[model samples]
Target: MKVLPSIQSPRDLRLIKKEHLPTLCEELRRTIIETASKNGGHLGSSLGAVEIITALHYVFNTPEDKIVFDTGHQAYAHKLLTGRQKAFGTIRTKNGLSGFPKRCESEYDTFGVGHASTAISAALGMAIARDQKKEKSKVIAVVGDGCLTGGMAYEALQNAGLLRSDLLVILNDNQMFISKRVGALGKALTKLLTTKYVQLAEEKATNFLKRFDELGNNAAKLAKRARSILFPGTLFEEMGFRYFGPVNGNDINEMIEVLENLKDVKGPVMLHVVTKKGKGYKPAEEKPTKFHGIGIFDVDTGDTIGKSNSVTFTQAFSDALLKLAEKDKSITAITAAMPEGTGLDAFRDKFPARYFDVGIAEEHAATFAAGLAAGGSKPVVALYSTFAQRCYDQIVHDICLQNLPVVFALDRAGLVGEDGPTHHGVFDLSFLRDIPNLILAAPADENEMQHMLKTAFDANAPFVLRYPRGAGFGVKMDDAPQNLEIGKGVWLKKGKDINILAIGNRVHPALKAAQALAEKGVDCGVANMRFARPLDTGLIDEALTLSPRLVTTEDNMLAGGFGSAVAEYLTDKQADFKLLRLGIGDEFVEHGKVSQLYDQLGMSAGQMTDHILKWKTK
Candidate 1:
């Protein structure tokens, strides 16, 4: 009989003979590898985490015993086991299974997660709720060594330590998140992996538990001292958690046995398990960083099937920053544990001392960049637009309010294809625009992105340079980056009938739209409005003189964003023009191709053209 198909739920998994568990693990791995090879989801972490999820489900009554996952990078196997095996193939697709654990999707998913370092906090809350209800159900948080680097994780740890709720915080140490891990904490974790105490602890685990019962108070204190010899003991123990073994996380049988032993352990216990990312897959094992979040790949050879030579906006930003850094000694690149994702790996490689990977700490990255700026260094904090929300207060108080010369390079700024609403960069313009000293610019193409970098560097104040994901417009880059006039926009085309004011990723489409409208007897023009803040009313005023009909388009939200800024400007001047603002609406956009989303939102070249052709006569 087929092992995986035979198992329907956690209860079914528990019913399997213990000796056949390894066969089940292999089946689970094969299913994940084959499914992800076609679907192109999280590979290294999820693949490695199969045993941990399986062991948790097998040992605990899952819907009753809650398991919370951090970031959901490793939740693929969790989804598979939680009655979602039949629908697992539809992940990251239109109207399909969510990439992350969604509360609405399954009763087994105790807590839904997307962002990092939130598992411990959410699990602790669930634990407290269970205690208050007089329930004995266990609550466990599956966190990576990487999630531990984020400040919020430490804060949650501190709170959990004090609360002393019946909790299990499993630190799944694989030593990498997206890219190679960084900082003192990573070094500490790496050291802990090689220690003999962790291995010994597993060997004498049952004996040690028996000793705990027999020993007097003095002998129990000695046992605690012995545990302190291990690396993470003091760190976790000092926080009031009873720490447990560094067992093999990839070993399902070992994890199940260890978990069953610790299931009833009282008051904030932590089980430290060491697993390898891409444990069963050779290609991912060799290069786990590249396979962290991958596209579709060949299962046999472990190569990404369709590779493109096009330089993405990330690469463009990285290349421009490198060139800029070559001349300026003070230029420093910083990211929140994302060097490869933000294209800062080359910068980190070239300028080791100047680069700072703060390790999944966005708020700290912002404030740290501010500190660097204060000490006479030009710091550029490169972060995804979605993650930037975590540090809004820090940006406002530490950087913008103080008028620090820190460049905030907001990457992946609009529809980030399959990552969905949580990862989109649409809100940056609206939030950052209202900040007094901050200057926000959205580049039209790769060349303009370079200029925007130069423009941000030259400004010597709080600045934001936002750009979209995927390949740039394929325009030739300038040999020497030029600093453009701040708050000014350049006119790409001029027409007598209508003016299409566009910004960022929407510019090229707007240009195409203007041409399409012209063929359809609507004389439309396109202007690349570079700065969303200083709405280019000089160009808008010029365009208003030619045509009373104006339309504003941006990749950002329509409310309080680029389009809204344009409307606010025109309305302030009491100008008489039939304005049609085009961009993302009030609803949260779902995961799909960026093109599909753009067309759906009526921001595509054809959609923009069609909408403008039917505009009311002035």
Candidate 2:
């Protein structure tokens, strides 16, 4: 009678009574909510996907039968079912189960995924591998409708249709992705697919026709053909997948039945399952985006556990952009599936018509912004630093190459904690710096972020203004956004013995370090070097006058980051200065709080001051 005890794996799940599956779904949802509430993870998506995941594991043979989850955030339920219940307590903690699926984490996790829209390609690869090995295993890619907007998913679909391989592509339609999904294609597809009820007359006619199969074979074939044509191009079918759903994802029995039926027969079929973003959770359902990714929140109230006293760089950018958008009619904003996370929800509300959310399609969003920019409208594409990597090509070919003015407001531009290496924004400076005709600015505080936003809008070339994830240092907000000269730096502290230049979130810490050094008779000059691309040569020259020992600090990787930019500039000018470049090392940063990681990496104010003091004594 106990479903939990009998279900050790998918094999065990297959033996369970069909009616008991609903209870199993409830258990899985309960486990997810409890574990995610305590550990802090992607709660909304996992909750939404509970029944669908359970049905897949129940109906399909897994481990041998590949199941690829797009973005991997929705795999918590999958992990629990596959002997990972013991490890759920340590979710996202050091040496624990990952929040996202990792190939190394489990044999059941067929493909490692952190970013969006990769399931189709990953599952297709497994399908081809299965064919080569002469294996009869089924390959299923469960992707969110949001992920479908990504160009990579469509590319995979195009190839899948061409090859006609045996595969099952499940479209988990939650009608949301962190926030409500955007783009006309996603909405049109949902409407056409979900709203289409099987006609009553056609069903009755089919039943009647089957009675005289011997006499009506040709007529039945014609009727079936007619039905397929009349059924408004279910987007996936147009792309070659045999369309099959608009089924209720939350119905455990229905899901199991649908999945079981589709298991054996398939040459790239799509099963569209509709789900609620926060199914069964009252508060979460009411406010799906708030619960999408929480940080140790109160389960009952769904309120965030602690208050962030400092104003975040994201909030500052949002305020500045909204103010600018109010005055500038041509100004428009776009976020590729990230509105709340990027703090663009305010801007979206202020300018609904001007705002565009292109779902998770970063590549399209980048090119779309270019088109807007080319058409004499100012388009600002704001996204997370890690997600910004996905659109590098478009940024080059569409925005940078043509030298259009597209402001890229890059949030979470440094070590994003808890989410680990895949979510870290440490590599943006390295990647964006060398891109021709691109201007990159890293702001020190809230005021600087506002100023940089204004500056980015003014420059009219491809501009990237990066800021970190967490709250800023509660710096005073600018009364009105002011444009500064492009590629300039400002000195925050003046001293004679040592010169410190810090970028973005590192500036505040560097200033504190300077104050610490001042007490020890080691005078330090600090510069809030806002611009990373155009290293302020004047500031560098001036710093050299005060001290031969120049230290550049940033939250990025030490290699090819702001520090390297400074070192390269000095080398080109043939200036003599001993440099200490402090930043994240080449190795992948592990999951930890941002402050703890900074302390461990010797980037904290006290740690930096200690190092400099010890160096002086040496």
Overall lDDT per candidate, in order of appearance: 0.85, 0.85
Cα lDDT of candidate 2 equals 0.85
RMSD (Å) of each candidate, 1 decimal: 5.1, 5.6
Q: Count the backbone clashes (under 3 Å) in each candidate.
A: 0, 2
lDDT of 1 at 157: 92
lDDT of 2 by residue, 428-487 (tens): 999899999999998888888888898999997999998999888987786999998888
> What tens digits encode model 1's per-residue C-alpha lDDT throughout 488-558?
99889898988889999899999999888778787788899999876677998998998988899989888
Can you tell me which runs of candidate 1 are displaced by over 4 Å? 176-223, 616-618
What CA RMSD would candidate 1 show? 5.1
TM-score, every prediction: 0.92, 0.89
